[model samples]
Target: MTVTVVVGNPKPASRTSTAATLVAKGLRPEAEPTVIDLVDFGAGLLGWGDPAVAAAARTVAESELVVFASPTFKATYTGLLKLFLEQFDGGTGLAGVLAVPVMLGAGPAHALAPDLLLKPVLVELGATTALPGLYLSDRTFADDGVIEGYSDRWRPVVRALTDAAKVADHA
Candidate 1:
């Protein structure tokens, strides 16, 4: 499967990015996901038709599965992510893709941010979200079993959906 991990953490190589990569790896051990650290894109995300930003968005849209990760900021996803997502067309841009929204927070208060905030945007962009969004605590994200447990329960379903979507697309 073609898998991608898109991180919206303001800092390069932040815990949010690491957790998202771990989740993708856990979901498919043999697959090395295309990791897009939006911080690297920087100012490119601010305008329309920026080649680099457009290419990255295209890669995410073309992937069968994508893990969209962000550190909770002001109780929601970062504006940086918002800038990137704005490039896609609502309700169609992410068609045939399955998205997993991941959020890392300092505390449990914003644990639902993944599902409540990010997933809706992915859905609006036409990405199928078949599993519950994952919320990881930043403190223990590296050693915690959250990624594995989530993959164990949801990976099979996601794979099935991804395959089915591909078949449907070709038909």
Candidate 2:
């Protein structure tokens, strides 16, 4: 299956990106994920019809699984993520795609940001969120087993959802 990672961190190769990649790998080890760091899109994100940005959106839309990640800002997801998400159509833009929202923060205060804020947007874009959103501590994510544990519990659920979506398509 095709898995895609979309990082909304402003920094090109930020820790958020790394965590997102790791999450994608943990979810489906065999899949070589397509990592799209929005920073690479540069100023194109501000305008419309940019080939690279459109390609990235298409890649995510076509993927079987996708990790939409960003660092928590003011207790919410970054505006950068919002900009990228706005590229997709309001409904059915991500049809048949399974999305996992991930957010990293300095403290635990905004741990619910992913579920409360990001997940809704993904749902509105027509993606199925089969499991709880993941929240990681920006300071300790690398050494923590959060991703592993989450994968253990939800990977199967993700697989099931994917299978169900496929079946629905054929029916």
Candidate 3:
């Protein structure tokens, strides 16, 4: 399976990026994961006519599974992330791809934003969304689901995504 991960965090070395990388690190070898830092696309994304944007969309089109990661900002993901996603035109944006959403926030209050926002967009693009969006707080993001005394208790999410990714039946 060709797995592609889109890092939507605008900040350099953001916690959300780190967490998404960690998940990619654990991908099964057969998947051949590819990580694309959306920042690399730059200002060209503002206009759909850029060739670079089309290239990025092509990469997304070829992947069997995709992981969309972004830090929860102002209750949703960053505008840059949305801009990058918008460049995906027609069937190339999604079709035949399964999307896993990973989001990080300073607090648990914005935990549901991943599903509320990312999933719908992915669906609109023609991708099948994986169940149980993963949400991690900045603190204890590597620990037992507890960030500095707060427990998000979101383990099933990771398990479900990993299990779903195994559905790579590319022929």
Predictions in order: lDDT: 0.91, 0.92, 0.71
lDDT of 2 by residue, 99-158 (tens): 999999999999889999999999999998877999999989988899999988888888
In terms of lDDT, the poorest run of 10 residues in model 3 is 146-155
* Per-residue lDDT value at 128 in model 3: 75
Error of 3 at 79 (Å): 0.6
lDDT value, candidate 2, whole model: 0.92
Clashing pairs in 1: none
Residue 37 of candidate 3: its Cα lDDT?
79
Lowest lDDT sum, 10 consecutive residues, model 2, at 157-166
Error of 3 at 20 (Å): 1.0
lDDT for model 1: 0.91
Query: Model 2, stretches more than 4 Å misplaced?
Result: none
What does candidate 2 score in Cα RMSD to the true structure? 1.0
lDDT tens readout by residue for model 3, 79-136 = 8789988876555468767677778888889989888888888888888775556778
Candidate 1 wrong stretches, greater than 4 Å: none
